[model samples]
Target: MITCQDILELQLDGVELIAGEEGLDHPVTWTYMVQTRPFAEHMNQGNFALCVIDYVRYDFEEAQRAMEELYELGISGFAVSVMEDREWIPQKMIDRANELALPLFYIRWEGASFVDIAQSVGKIILEHEIQNKRTGDYLYNLLFGYDINDRYIEKISSQFGINFTNPCRVGIIVADRRYGINLEQDEHIYEYYANYLN
Candidate 1:
């Protein structure tokens, strides 16, 4: 019986609450996001646990049984994530998600077809995920204010080891709708760009 509040806040435009129950709490096999690595801060791998216990119950046996059932049902993080985005990911299905630690995803588009609904939904989710990560990283670096170019200092290059042969600056480049999103000043972004150039 995960309540609406239990669903974590997201940057997405909207996520439909297709008939959620208040009293029918299920396991914690729900993956709120699709991008796992970028969102290690939020939906970290296996950080959220599954449980049937109420607000007061705290027994290990019950948890063990529930987890066993969930695992046997074929619920992984990735799988559970895909289920949660669907309008109707059942309790039993949730239990399965707990077992597998699957992330929430849309069903209309799951295959390789770029035109499918799953692909469309995936694009939106990925964009939101990347944006949130980029903003967080940028803000963190801005507050810390460390010099990233120093790390790349070499004998001949300017601060960031340009190597002279192919002299140029570097910055992370992410391709968006016919455009490239360049976060050049941030350390992480520069690191990505530097590594990519090398």
Candidate 2:
């Protein structure tokens, strides 16, 4: 579970104070100031971001670009340092992450409150985005199966959103992994196919 102290430590432990060293120790409410900035007034609390790729190419400059853009747009997101070489993750990257101060959502704690809070916000935003994008194209493919309806191939759409498109036949994927841990990328298939299996 995420404790207040855990948050303080994860953030403080990874950061390197550059210019705004004060921001690190600053109250979480100072996030409000970031939210109100000209570029990001539209952003609000409980907003979350997820960034995925071949963590190999993850770079400090890339992190900076993404953070600056999101800050302007008023969103809160944290990047996972999935890389091994500690040297690759530079002070600027740490500084940038600290400035933006997005939550680290990749790790799991049995009952971390702060992680749960961030996830709740992120899930809502993603769900809304998916709802807006489901222009009947998804349901059609979902029922008919994408391979059978190949001619009707559309831009690969999202199930849980965030651009993970999967084509489901009449099969449900059952995993031994824990609940939320295994739910990524293939839920719609389970929605229909699970009934057949269960």
Best by lDDT: 2
* C-alpha root-mean-square deviation, each candidate: 16.8, 18.0
| Superposed Cα deviation of residue 73, candidate 2 (Å) | 1.6
lDDT tens digits, residues 1-198, model 2?
112223334443332223333333321211221222233433432233333323444455655565567645544344333343233445666665555554333322222333444544335434534554464446555666745543344344333333425554554466433345435323523432332233
Lowest-sum lDDT 10-residue window in model 2: 27-36
Residue 38, candidate 1: C-alpha displacement in angstroms: 27
- Kindly list the per-residue Cα lDDT of model 1 for residues 1-198, writing each as its tens digit: 221233323222333222223311322323333222223333322222222222234233333343344334432322221222333445664454334434332222232221232334335445544654555455456448667454333442332223445655645455233323433224333433332332
Residue 195 lDDT in candidate 1: 29
The total of clashing pairs for model 2 equals 5
Give one clash count per candidate, in the order shown: 23, 5
TM-scores vs. true structure, each candidate: 0.24, 0.29
Instruction: State the lDDT at 156 in candidate 1.
Output: 21
Off by over 4 Å in 1: 1-18, 21-115, 146-198
TM-score leader: 2
